[model samples]
Target: MSSQKMRTAQIVEYNKPYQLCERPTPVCGDNDLLIQVHAAGFCHSDLQVLHGQFPAHLPLTPSHEPAGKIVQIGAQVQGSWKVGDRVGVLNFKNSCKSCVGCRQQLRRRHRTDPRFCQSREMAGFKHDGAFAQYMLADPDTTVHLPEKVSFEQGAPLMCAGATVWGALQKLKPDVQPGEAVAIVGIGGLGQLGVQFAKAMNFRTVAIDNRDEGRKLSMEVSEKLKPDLVVDSSAPDASDKILEFTSGEGLAGIVVCTDSIQANAWSLEQLGNGGVMVPVGLPKEKWQFDSSALVFRELVIKGVYVAGTEDVQEMLKVVAEHDITSHITMLEFDDIPGIVEKYTDKAMKGRLVVKIA
Candidate 1:
């Protein structure tokens, strides 16, 4: 247990910057766990929060993706999770179980009481997140970090990994073991998506624009043995993807980045009856060709943060496959540098903080 209260990063007003201040340790209620944050992943999501783009509570801590060991528990938690269990924190701090998105009330607040939804408090965004030394979590949403996994490897998975994994699973429902699963973009979410696609036995393809992005993406394909890796910036990148699929078109494409032009080009690259699932959020509008969809019968869908069932399946898939993220570990002081210096270059291969 900690000796005293903790210091946390808070954003008191919109676009006003963040503040680090000391505050009393939160009480770990019965259904919750007090995590002594060993590492927290500074995300682009946090950037949105800092800009006040995230739709959430104010005067809240903004670090969400986190991993740490349990230091306390509330009275109502009955899981095997204990004070010493290592766990990964999720983004949906408290997803109202009654809400349609949380899981049709599936990750229900109280299993017996449908009226009582699970009150999972998201670290950083919804409440004071993992930008501090400690975080509060619900056993229902927190994934138990494996003994073999380092704190840094699991931190980003709490958010970035889960979001992409969730999208990939939705795109590939019953594909043959070796069918092609293409992922667009190789940033935070795409990198994990590429790895998970390969790990799940799909013929994985990694696509990106920047040379460095392509270089980093290939690391997963090279090490994990993906079927193909293409830089979408290439003059004939669309045709290259077509070549990999044997002119039959990919079984499914998960567009993890929000570049509208890139995604539209990706749609063009799709073969007959292909599906495009978009995960990234863009500020601008996206235009689609109705004529092409009508002729080819293409399918397009937009995915949200993630469903709770998505979380459950991802935790299992990550565990069963023994997937370890490629992360660059940093200390707490790197936050400002991440925002100011490396905003665009930051991707899945690196985690910007080791909070403990």
Candidate 2:
């Protein structure tokens, strides 16, 4: 409400640097909440959007993971959402209520269907997103930020945390408490996956080729650290994982990296009747051995960013278990620098930009 104009970082063209410029503040719609963005997370998806891998409207603001205070509430919003409330928003929005996915979501038959509705608009991809000072959020896909979690952490939790949370959920009915679970590629998402698996009472194994990732998995928190960390590049990595599981192999594996090799290898570490949930998107087509899959009765499922209910539970677990993201905080102006950093080497943890 302070100004009609707002500062934004936009992808003016594919494969080019962002353009920092001014745009009119977004108008809050009947079913939308206007957020005064305080903190926004920089994710690999942003890079994908920039490179045209994830097609987007050109000259669009970009950042899907955003956490901030509500400036205005829409009249049609059904919840107790109001001004001054802290919140984090999932990227998918504008669901057509008449669609099959939306109908299932309304009946609670499927919790994750609304986001998959064909008519939905994806923030930072198909629509203007949170890279601006203010953005519109759909109430159906938004969650409250706990007081214990800061805006910086809450921002990344909207995407990275929700993603791993959904992947782990796929293991239910197959993997149980005290069973071994491996979190592959311990970077932004895998590190959190390990912690979440531990919090869920599974014996967790953190797998990564990088020294920083392995170190970060152990350093997350005392209550949520992985029980074991393995070097994925080692020749005996699968042997070590099986050994950790008392020679039975892992009951579940969460693939958090987009590396084709890592995903293929992770499938080999699963025990009989084990579940493998992949949350990462690789450019190349994924191939698996049919004989192994059929003989072992392995189950492979794909999960996207979590639903609103799942995200709420993840935040509760994060707050209760003291799980935190080791973040590199930057200002809004450092958007280009963050993009450059994500290209070559992986950062220790997630990247967050303080916008306000």
Candidate 3:
């Protein structure tokens, strides 16, 4: 509490190493909670922010998934939130209440969908995020971490976990219990998708390319016990998936990789009337056969980070099922190295920075 300055990892330029420096402690606003960060998870989106692929302002503190204890609370923040509470912050900091998405949320008695709102202020993009020792978060965008969940586990849930949870929820309409669902890419997000698919009573199929990814997918398959694991590196990977499902094909496919080829190939595995949810951000545009979609009656949808309600529900599901993230913890000074590893596709699973 006596510290007047805090350490922050900031992006001074595009595709550059984060500059760790000392800055004045952030001031808490009327509706903000001053958090002392315990753990901040490294997300693929963070890499996008660093490479300037995503829309981010310069000289930004880049990290959206954070879990910590509330050191100070704003006077205007009501409800049961208070100092000393363990909490996780979401990427969407705040949304304009007058927007159509916000009004829809109000009518449904749910949290706002900031991604759809035009006046949304996102953490690590529009505002300073949790890559610092001390950062401010809007109380409405914060979720309480249960006693059963550790800070390391809670941190990645903000973005990575919540994203797949939201995507699975969106695909629920097309997916039926006992039917197979394919999760492309076995990295941070795909792993979570595998767990959620199994927990939701769907027979999960994990798909990844050859080499290290295949090995990682096999390991995850053994640990999580998915119904089937498919290596898309094979020429007949889609045929293998169809064979696994007994020619019914997958009820829905969730594409979690940024590879344009993987995204395009995943569509071939979807059954008639099946939906394909693309969650990863690929730099280049994807090309697919238009006749295939028209004849198969396929549905293609894009999903962003979750709304607050989805995060809350996802937390409950995670706790109930005892779902945990595969994370590698690193010290604060290792931020630069971690970014480099992520860019090179050398890092496995999610990486969490131990800030406190």
Per-candidate TM-scores read: 0.88, 0.96, 0.93
Q: What TM-score quantifies how close candidate 1 is to the native fold?
A: 0.88
Instruction: Candidate 1: count the clashes.
Output: 15
Candidate 1 lDDT tens digits, 1-356: 44478877677787765666777787777677888998888777788888878677777877778889998988888778777888886766544655554465455433321113356555576568888888788666677776666788778887888778767766655455688888888777777787788877888888887766666666653546456778777788768877888888787788877888877877776667777888877899887788777898888876655644566567666666666666777667655455654355544465647888
lDDT tens per residue, model 2, 1-356: 53599999999899888889998898888888999999998898888888898776688889999999999988888988878999999999878877877777767864435587879989988788888899999888889999999999899899999999999998998899999999998888887888899999999999999888899888776878888999999889878997898888889999988888888888989889989998888888887777778999999998878889989999999999888888889898888677776755766788898999
Error of 3 at 149 (Å): 1.8
Each candidate's clash count: 15, 0, 0
Better of 1 and 2 by TM-score: 2
State in Å the error of residue 90, model 1: 1.4
lDDT of 3: 0.84
Candidate 2, which segments miss by more than 4 Å at Cα? Answer: 104-113, 344-346
